[model samples]
Target: MPEATEDLARRGDRAFLAIGIAVALWLVATVIVLPIVMPDGPSQAVTDYLGALRDGDVDAAYDAAGAERHDADAYDTSFLRSEALSTDWRIQSVWTSDDLSPYDAKLTGGIEPEGHETQPGVRVVNAVISHGDATSRGQFYVQETGSRDFILNPFVYADAGATLGFVDLNGVTSPAHRADNGDKLTKKDSFALFPGFYRLYQHNDDLFRADPSTLMVLPGTDVDISTSLSLTDKGNKAAAKAVRAQLDTCEKSTQLAPSDCPFNPLDDGAADSVDAYDHEYRDVKDIKWKVLVAPKFDIEPRDGEGPGDFELVPRNYATIRLTAVGVDIYSDSDKAKRFSTVCPIDPEDLVLTVTASKSFTVSGPAHTYAGRACGRDH
Candidate 1:
């Protein structure tokens, strides 16, 4: 009897082991093999769409990626026929999740504005693409003064919490404009300067978009955003030589000659991205000369408080009337002037006259560009 009981128990254990192994094999096949074989939702669709786009079937490609682009509302197929679809732009990746269908790609990242002309060097992106492959390498004929991982933008010299209201450095002062003798914002101005946190904040409707239209003042010049950029890859001495040569041999008759001066015309007319310019600061084409509205506010004093209780604050509002007298910032890469030899403070834009009912910190001290480039309470 005991021997019979032992045989039965062994049989039951063997049956249990067999059932466990079968279940394990079935799970493995379902989890791993099925994903490899199946082409459903965004995955299968994204692959087909990318292939169609490459094959020049834009109609079919758009149909596939129609849901992913912001230009869908235009109702115009002709717009899609431009550069991003035809030339210089190509797909890098297309991701389709259960909820999102993102078309990722790299554009022939233009070294000039409008992203028209392509540069050399490859940069990758995982975001939704509407233009070209975001991974295309870039080789800029004219190296810009910034770093670009996915987005290309140049920066201006501004202290953190910097205000860029109009300032007259040519000895003329106005309520709308301040006078800095020679103060310069020391920050390297461009989205590419710090690519890590800056890019992630720029995505998803670009809620944290930083304005590239800011103007910077040269240290000591006191003029706002008026420094010229040098194009030649030579040091200070060599660049000075090149600029002198360029200024001498160039004919006045050439269309691009007179207009290419460091002091740009109000109607700035220059063409072709030279080593003397930035990709973002593309002359007067991308820039507009409009008035700024700077508003003012006052702090209310307490009833029992003395005169010290009253505080004067410039309300964060708007400023109007400051005009774009001239664009002094062109590429100084030819090395016309050293980056900055004088103090960053614009002596001309300094506090010429402060008229207020309440007294405050009257004038700032002489600032140097040698140290931190932030504001000196301007």
Candidate 2:
């Protein structure tokens, strides 16, 4: 009986050893294979793209994009370059993970805890070294939600200066748009830059068109918006009449070319109207207040100017002064000037918090626009 027990014990030990070895082999196989089976997503794309961008191979980076993003003829340099449209910037952080959202994966680092602010055109990495630096700056989400891609903005864009048709960001050299034309500009050809900052008057005219911040400030005249918008205040009755006329004319003029830009006439059909584009998605009238660009920025007047393509571009100059005015949805308390240091193109950034006494008073909105909007028309 003792001999039989010893034999059984040896056999059991052998079985245990075999089982352990099999498990070890399986574990090693998994270690070797799991990664091979996993999907490559935003992080991979972001890292590869960032590498290319850092190396200044924009064409290579552009090629790696998805189909819609890859369509070169339609989504060309201008589309990619116009992202510099926003000069104001902020950085937010998040954790480092192989599993990040497709949109969020385009970041090279983790999100940040404290945010850092800088002027619009500075790059993300350099912005960190600016006036108010931050730390542990993780993944960046432009706004509160995990959406807005801070890096894609012009500040981080590898070729923003090139996109602007300038050799660099400084003002020393004329932009390629200007240089290519032999510096000989025609009457109609001029440049239109989306404002570094601005506001849109609800009743300044018939149509509450906000795309071209100031409809036609005309060239050679330094029309301080701070003063001009202020002087033009009419009571509700006057405002209503003007709104009706402008709407009627806009609607009528727009009929000639449904494809023409409803506003911001590039060619005939670039309908860049904030109201017209968003007419169906959200009711423009339902919006509580019209935006007023705060006075910290300048817009060179665009009088006697027309559309521009690769050729004749309009050049406007502006210097931002930290001042703001209110867009009174309720009353015309003051109207002595054409523009006032009231309402800002971006309300959330800075509008006098103490400007008004009540919530019903003229405070900025959750968001504002100094941008051109286009879409599936309502």
Q: What are the clash counts of all predictions, listed in order?
A: 63, 60
> What is the alpha-carbon lDDT for the whole of candidate 2?
0.27
TM-score of every prediction relative to native: 0.22, 0.19
lDDT of 2 by residue, 30-112 (tens): 89988764322333433443344334445544443221232322111332333222223222211224222233222322222
Q: Whole-model Cα lDDT per candidate?
A: 0.27, 0.27
Displacement of the residue 248 alpha carbon in candidate 1, Å? 55
lDDT tens digits by residue: candidate 1, 62-82: 455333333322221212331
Candidate 2, residue 261: lDDT: 15
Q: Which stretches of candidate 2 lie over 4 Å from their true place?
A: 1-41, 66-76, 79-378
